[model samples]
Target: MIHIRKSGRDDASGLAAIWRDSVLATHDFLSRDDFIEIEKLVCEQYLPKAEIWIAVEDGRPVGFMGMTESHIDSLFIAPDQHGKGIGRQMIAHARALAGILTVDVNEQNVQAVRFYRHMGFVETGRSPTDDQGRPYPLVHMRLGEQRPTDD
Candidate 1:
């Protein structure tokens, strides 16, 4: 059985590995050099500063999420563990914590967009680049709120 828990300092390496594997599985649009650069940032910067949650099964972390306030900064499940409801469980947990939730997903990551839509998130806007000013576009979404209608 999988359970959600807060991460510890010791879990950083394991979680970074999961991040690497999950990105390789899902983020096919990333260039090789970009992947390596992002991996370093994740390991050396982002993961350390963010509030993270882990999905553990059998005492091992199989997935993780990073959140800031009501926004979901990142979420990744072990590639081998996909379609097993771990992502869903983590989103549910985040909703419980933050009330309303928001997330920005890469436009190229169709699978993640579909999952968020299935969880009732609606597109609020779009950006021409990701947070890091990369060329990957982002689809901004919000849950538990009515989508804005153009006047």
Candidate 2:
């Protein structure tokens, strides 16, 4: 059975792998050089500094989320695990811990935008460029007061 748990020092590589695979699958808008640069940053910097929660199954990490207080810095599910309710579970976990949850989804990723909306997150703002000042836009969303059932 899959479960959510706090990440450990050893889980960094696995989480990074999940991030790479998920990005390759969902972030098709990223250029090759951009992807490489981001991958290095995610592995070498972000993963080490962020507070993370991981979705583990059979002793391995299948997905991971990086969070800061009530804000979700990043959420990535393994490409093979998409549509399997892992993301939903992670979001629920985050909400329980943080009370109010927030996330920034890439505007180019229609799937992610739709998923967040389905999870009861409403868009609050937008940024023309990502944190790195890239051309990719971001849709900032926050969870509503009423939680939606996973239908």
Candidate 3:
């Protein structure tokens, strides 16, 4: 079973590697220069600012997610760890913590778009260019509000 927990500075390196590897596996459309720049920013800047969470399997770090009050800034899994439900676990935690989950995913990433839609997030908006102003398009999604359950 995968365990989920808050991350600290010590987990930075592992998180960075997962980010790099995941992007490499799925974001092949990005140019080498853009990819390197994004990798640098994610490792050196964004990861530390976001409320980071790690998913560990067999005592090893396998996936992570970063969120803020209004957005899920990042979510990545070790390439070897895909199809293992780690992403679903992380998204469940994000929904509980953030209350509302909003995420921007590259439109070219069909698997990710399908995954988010499957998780109850619907496309609320779109941008012609990604956050970095690159040619890649972005699909913005938001989860539908949940109804309260009786006690």
Candidate 4:
């Protein structure tokens, strides 16, 4: 059985390990250096601001998902854990915390795009580039029904 729980600073190493492994397994996308950078940035800044959740199976952390008020900072599962509903569970948890949840998927990450679509997040818009002028295409997605309170 998989159990989900909040992660604290002690979980940083676990999160970093998961992040590196996942990125390396996707050799079609991230280079090792890029994954390292992401691991550092997420652990140092993003995860701290967000609610970080870890999926533990038999006492071992197998996946994690992080969310802030306006965005899903990260969602990653072990390579062996894909297609096992962990991602869905994480998304559901994030949605429960916010009336509307948002996330950005790189245009090049086709698997992630499909996964987000399956979770009912729509392509509301796109961003042109990364702050450093890298031409990375970002697809924005939002969840929840439209309400009169939407702004």
Which sequence of candidate numbers ranks them by TM-score, best first? 2, 1, 3, 4
**TM-scores of all candidate predictions against the true structure:** 0.94, 0.95, 0.92, 0.83
lDDT of 4 by residue, 22-139 (tens): 7666535655566667667776876666688999999888999877675887788998888999888888777777768889887777888899998888999988864344566778
Q: Local error of candidate 1 at 134, Å? A: 1.0
The lDDT-based order of candidates, best leading, equals 1, 2, 3, 4
Q: After superposition, how far is residue 25 of candidate 1 from its true place, in Å?
A: 0.6
Candidate models: Cα lDDT each: 0.94, 0.93, 0.89, 0.79
Which run of 10 residues does model 2 get worst, by summed lDDT? 142-151
The candidate, 2 or 3, that scores higher on lDDT is: 2
- Taking the tens digit of each residue's C-alpha lDDT, what string does model 3 give over 71-92? 8888898999889899999999
Q: lDDT per residue, candidate 2, 39-143, as tens digits?
A: 999999999889999999998899999999999999999999999999999999999999889999999999999999998899999999999999999999999
**Model 2 regions lying over 4 Å from their true place:** 147-151
lDDT of 1 at 57: 100
Model 2, backbone clash pairs (residues 3+ apart or across chains), number: 0
Model 4's alpha-carbon lDDT is 0.79
